[model samples]
Target: MRVLVCDDEPLARDRMRRMLERIPATLCVGEAENGQELLERVPSVYPDIILLDIRMPGMDGLQAASRLSESDSPPAIIFCTAYDEHAIAAFKVNAVDYLLKPVRQEDLEKALSKAGRVNKAQMLAVRRETGVAQPEQANAKEREYISVRSRKGIDLIAVADVRYFLADQKYVTVRHSQGETLLDETLKELETEFGDRFLRVHRNALVALSYIEALEHKGNQFYLRIQGVEERLAVSRRHASSVKKLLQSL
Candidate 1:
């Protein structure tokens, strides 16, 4: 499997590279210092798997994984981070697996094994939980669309055309190429259902990584611009590093 290893620390990157050499199906296709480098190399390398770190200098791994999910096809994402607090969020993002820092060879092997079973849709669900059932279901006919409950009735939206989802108190606004629709679900509920395709940019907002145009930083604050949208979304201070890293990767 072609693999991309991303981390800010040189020693950490080297250690991951060395450990990967022991795996038979794995190949170190590239190494990135931050999320930005990963994004730039993704189109050309087309790695099968990515070993991503949660923290970095510019862009962090979580943001990078979010951006990668926007591509026509995305690789399996395995978060390799030091913090346990991110585990819940990582699973919400549909990461194939989460590996704590100082990744063990056995754990890496297990992750790779999991990656091998995953397909593109599964990878997409892992990124945003857009309703894909499993890694193998990516190729199944039943997995291509999502049903949204609205005042009109049950509407099915093709998963690919969805741009983003906005949370407004108890309601969720589903934004797509055609327009927007309101659903009676919380952001947290949507996170459970479509976690593969949506990422929480803020506490209330879950956005489609593909629709993100750019990220701007002013002092310690950060905001995201979405394609065809005039509004700039604010990212929390806690998620700032991850957002920047994701933009760099894009």
Candidate 2:
């Protein structure tokens, strides 16, 4: 894997270069002191990944990442920062992983391994075969991830991975394959955005239509049974009829 190290500190850049040398099948193509210099070298070096630092003299890492996101085949970005406060902002710019400094060898290897799994060449080949959309059109609609703020950091969950969303007071709990995460977005806003795929089961809950296993009735209350989860979600009387109709359609 071709990696470009970008940091303002000379020692920091040298340390990254040395680490990359130790990793097999990895090359440190170039090093840049700031974001502007990083951008200048990117076209020529054509790196697969960039180990970026957040704070610099000019054109910070976030700004540089945003600019790179516009490219058709942008290199995957792994942010190496000392501050944890910028975690939210870093993932907002679609960073692959945010590693706090001084970064560990294991963490760097894991991040690179994760980034390598996304095969851009294979994606383009499939797109061409299916005639789904032009490369520019496909790239334009790439923001399918939902960013959730948590105590650890911002976690990017793909919309397809979600099973249901349950509203509890100010926050919404997003139930997905990897378990649940708290989201700041309201249930109403989520319904407005993803109404087509998500069904309104109650006033406070929206379930993914794809994961609807069955609807169960116990006493006077109706409950929804999800495919993978054992816990059944309560179905309100108001939306029960609509839910049944949706089930029949499926």
Candidate 3:
């Protein structure tokens, strides 16, 4: 399997590399010093798995993992961290395995063994929870398409074709280029699955990054307007800070 080792510390990265060599005769496609580099390399190499560190410069592993999980064919993720606090959260994000550092050969083997058993769709599901690795590149090839179940059976929706997703009780309402469809998934789950393409506007809603036209505030309430959609989405006051940060970056 092609693998990418991501860590900020040079020694940590080197140690992981050495451990990887002993586990199996897998190709070390490349190594990333931080999350940003991981995002840049993932698309080009399409590694089968990524050995991610929880702490790093620029973007932390958790944040990076959140982004990488949105790719069409995202690599299996195994958290290699020095801390144990993130173990529960890691599982919540659908991480295959969580290995605390110094990483042991036994632990790495177990993680890989489990990874081998997972199917492609399961891996894709994990990626969806973590979010997309990077912003949609204008020239980059579109990876996977989402199939939304409709009255007409399954309606295939391109990732780029979606505008936003609204949480409705147990199901999520997907707003696409043509129209909306309901799926049996929560907004939080969808946030984990399609994080790369969508951003959380409120506790119960996520909006596609591409479809967001602007953010407007009236009185104490904030709202997000989509390009084609006429209705404005309410942005919760609690998440306003994060929303502003995202908008400023864009």
How many residue pairs clash in all the candidates, one count each?
22, 0, 12
Worst 10 residues of 1 by lDDT: 131-140
Whole-model Cα lDDT per candidate? 0.72, 0.77, 0.71
Question: Candidate 3: deviation at residue 137, Å?
Answer: 38
Per-residue lDDT for 1-250 in model 1, tens only?
Answer: 5688999999999999999888753568788999999888776554678899988888888888887787744787999989988888777666899999878999999998888668434454443433222222222233456678766878888755566778887777877778887767677765665555455777777776545655777777788876657778888876676555443432
The TM-score leader among the candidates is: 2
Give the better candidate number (2 or 3) by lDDT.
2
- Candidate 3: Cα lDDT at 104: 82
What is the TM-score of each predicted model, taking all chains together? 0.48, 0.50, 0.48
Sort all candidates by TM-score, best to worst: 2, 1, 3
Alpha-carbon RMSD to native, per candidate: 14.3, 18.3, 14.6
Residue 16 Cα positional deviation in candidate 2, in Å, after optimal superposition: 0.7
Error of 2 at 18 (Å): 1.0
Model 1: how far is 143 from its true place, Å?
30
Q: How much is 99 displaced in model 1, in angstroms? A: 0.6
Worst 10 residues of 3 by lDDT: 132-141
